[model samples]
Target chain A: MTDVPSYLSPTGQEIVFLLLGVVAVGAALLVVTTRQLVHAALWLVVCLGALAGCYLVLTAEFVAWVQVLIYVGAVVVLLLFGIMLTRAPIGRAADLDSRNRPVAAVVATATAIVLVTVVIDGFRTAYAPLEPGGGSAREIGSSVFRTWVLPFEVLSVLLLAALVGAIVLSRTDIRGRR
Target chain B: MHVVYPAVVSALLFSIGVYGVLARRNTILVLMSVELMLNAVNLNLVVFDVWLRDRLHSGQVLTLFVIVIAAAEVGLGLAIILALYRNRATVDLDRLRALAEFPVPSPEDADDHLPENATEETAGQASRASAATGPTRPPGRDDTPEATP
Candidate 1:
């Protein structure tokens, strides 16, 4: 068989992935540690954008676009609106509740360790190379509409519920009427 | 491209998101951090899904679902924040300590105490402070003169 194209080779992909991964991580760190709320939100956008890049690198074009359309586009806009409406303190709070830092750190660390171990072990034990024709958007469309129909419908209902819950929580006259 | 590298990148993004959620205190910022984590997860799912490249296309479909949910989450989150702002002048999470079981403040009385000046002043102060403090200004607040210092 002829050799795979150099551009499509695993090595090339790895380099791209490495660069994007570093960007994603650095952005994420900024998102969490930054003192300013708006800054954190902006950093989150960077992190999410980097994630979209990762998906693109993986050749999951559909997922990458969805990530942008949903998380970056819709969710982040909502977050910014929340900040604006609530008038969250512009400056970092003098003391932003450091009481739970130790506990949160311990739990997060443990979770990370366990997750990393499981993922690594899984990769090592079940390393199945993907077929060349895999990851096409057309195939994904069919699968979502066909096999995953039930879950898809359920998800719609769940979204409806969330919408209703949001409305109820935001209603100004709930207690007033009673 | 090889899926491993993207997976690693996704992991790093996820870890940083975790750190943000843990460290940040502003509710809006915290929510933003959650979005970051979600994006990271979305990257991992898409990367692996692409690699699998089976007829199933499991990852792409799941990513769609995540997007939908994230949209709904933000809509609701913003509403809650608005209500909270009405009840309490500040959206600082520290000040919302008793949100769960606490009595909602009466709007009639609450509106009178709303921090019109406080927010304006803080915004102004943060801008001036950033210039005065150093070139490294914190993230969210606009450092403009209009904001009362």
Candidate 2:
């Protein structure tokens, strides 16, 4: 505890993480506020990609790659397909926001203030020096199979359930039995 | 790295997600907001995993699980949304108030909700409220006619 580094003189990792954090937060803000539907999804890509970078900086290399593959690659493409299928306007339209924008803004601001205050107060002196290889693919894979195997298997079942549910929901001919 | 930086960033991202979910009118946009919130949680998990150096690396493993769940959620959500659009021909959250507490009033009841001396201002207010509730007609009754054609 006494050996924690001072924040006044940050290290290189801290600098890179802060820059990535700024990009993530900004892109996330843009994702929510953008009027153009397509643009919002694009901004989400930037945001998620930045988050992956943050994960990398934090030394979770496996999680970083998984984040990029699942979120930035697959999820964004699905959202884009959804946008097109729904015939959302190609360009910006005025009604992207609902009537309670001000209320939402207030609530979100309050949430941020409370969360940031609590985190900073609690973790003011806490520091964790990054070490490579802890989150390497081999380490995480072995851990998944060895320690978290049950949950991992359960998650696969959940994925299969979701796949079937989606198919059933989307296909008009799949009527439920009376 | 100071733990505060990632924690603070994740907090802000979650708040932005809260705002998007509350304020966005499109269902898909709301889904994107949900993803943002999930990613924020993932960041927190990864940060803690790195910090704690747990023997099992539970935090990172859980992060991977969360990502998988998020993918499944997006798939199901998009399917539901597509189904909605097919039947309703629109995906605006504001317009999809079928289950709102205030059921849309009947033709006769519409007059009762408004005063006899209703001005344009009052009429607008009344209509807006009604629109928010939407018509509570039998679901199949509305779409069936169109679907058969």
TM-score of 2: 0.88
- Which window of 10 residues has the lowest lDDT sum in candidate 2 chain A? A169-178
Q: Which candidate is the best by DockQ?
A: 2
List the candidate 2 regions with Cα displacement exceeding 4 Å: B100-142, B145-149
lDDT of 2 by residue, B76-144 (tens): 999999887775566878656546433343566445435332222333454455455555532332333
Q: What is the per-residue lDDT of model 1 for residues B1-149, given as tens digits with 9 covering 90 to 100?
A: 54445555566556656765675556676667677677767776776666565456677788788778777877787777766555445556644444332223355534644544465344435445555755543432223333322
| Candidate 2 all-Cα RMSD | 6.0
- TM-scores, in order shown? 0.72, 0.88
Worst 10 residues of 1 chain A by lDDT: A1-10
Q: How many backbone clashes does candidate 1 have?
A: 8
RMSD to native for every prediction? 11.2, 6.0
- Enumerate the candidates' DockQ scores in order: 0.29, 0.64
Show where candidate 1 strays beyond 4 Å: A1-10, A91-97, A125-133, A174-177, B1-4, B99-149
